[model samples]
Target: MARVLFVVFGGLAYLIFFATFLYLIAFVGDLPGVPRTVDHGPAGDRITAFIVDLGLIGLFGLQHTIMARQGFKRGWTAIVPKPVERSVYVLFASIALLILFAFWRPIPQPVWAVENPLAVSVIWGLFALGWLIVLSSTFLINHFELFGLKQVYQNLRGAAPSPPRFRQPFFYRLVRHPLYAGFIIAFWATPEMTLGHLLFSVGMTIYILIAIPYEERDLVGALGDDYASYRGRVGMLFPRLRRASPSTPPLEARDS
Candidate 1:
């Protein structure tokens, strides 16, 4: 019964996180339906809005970075069941994102607005491609595990989760972090760039840059030589001029 209840909790958490992720796409893209986007939102004092936006980004960075640390997980799991630890992390991260989305204030003053029809179309194409890469990269590893569903399912089945292994499938072969690369592309490729949008992109880019070292440190500690060797050969977020053999392993990224 406890195991079953955990599965229920995990399922709910997964649903919430998935919904938040989808909404995030819309929010970042400034799509039509979302109530508040990076560029479209309630007006406020520019200075105040800037501070608030900065704080929101900081909050997310803290939550994302701190919770993902191995030290945090080592202590955190003493209270949270091992099976649901990842799920709880996902839940908390989703909540942080939701809070950011809810309180975001847009400074819609134009930074750059592309007038050329062809350029605009190209930028939009890159935006879509970025999102596609992000989503597909999740599957290249284990999406269920990355999102926490697989751990809970294993718990329900009274089975142990698989150990981490090294990998660089397809997009990963080109870049060590295709997911982050995708986000960078999506954020910067917009045809209409506003102060708010620029801030969002810049903030996220800084966070990604800062986060990568710590994440890589963790990966190296956990994966040792295999990952180190892989890192040596591949670009952190871009394709190397040289190539590696087509063999990839299953090294989990936790969720970069």
Candidate 2:
């Protein structure tokens, strides 16, 4: 059946996405055996490297941002089956990431390297924790859905996927975009900050910043007043110390 085939395809795409994500962790951290890391490639022309690296990142960002918009989704699903649209998105994203990791030109110059053992350990720990937060946050929301597995599975089962809901559970309460926060923490908490690492961090950080407004716009449109109210009460990428006034109405109820 087409439905079963779609589910299988989605599952395969998820496997690739998961592997690529793990490889990204190792790539950023410069773990063993990864051919290219944030700071582990041979020296090359600075200008050429800069342009190439930026192009790679820009391509990824362009694909990611464009595909995420509601307008694009509306048009895309007109041609592609709605159930597999997400899988296609995931596949392309994974390919983009793979291209970045494969051809990235590392600058290899140290911007900062901690000499203190204690500080080094702490920073490394924070890097790991940042990744943990990113992974955990997906589950706190819907890991399967976020990764495209749930959509195809539900379709195969003849069930309509549920609408997006406004939620502020766990890290969501701390920041409207905890995944981005986690990425920021992971990118910057490195004990050794190479020029290449810095480029990747700064570039991605810029993308994250640019992405928030657009993403929030989409969220406001999808979730309406509920998201607008939550936005007022929560920080975009950091936690608020104090809760909103008790007079503020509670967020609209929906399944978490």
Q: Which candidate is the best by TM-score?
A: 2
Residues 127-244 of candidate 1: C-alpha lDDT, one tens digit per residue: 9999999999999977999989999999999998888877777887778999999999998999999999899999999999999999999999988888897787789997888665
Off by more than 4 A, model 1: 243-256
User: TM-scores across all candidates?
Assistant: 0.94, 0.96
Error of 1 at 229 (Å): 0.4
Q: What is the lDDT of residue 178 in candidate 1?
A: 94
Report the number of clashing residue pairs per model: 3, 0
Model 2, 148-238: lDDT tens digits are: 9999999999999989987777889778999889988998898889888899999999999998999999999988989999998889997
What is each predicted model's overall lDDT from 0 to 1? 0.91, 0.90
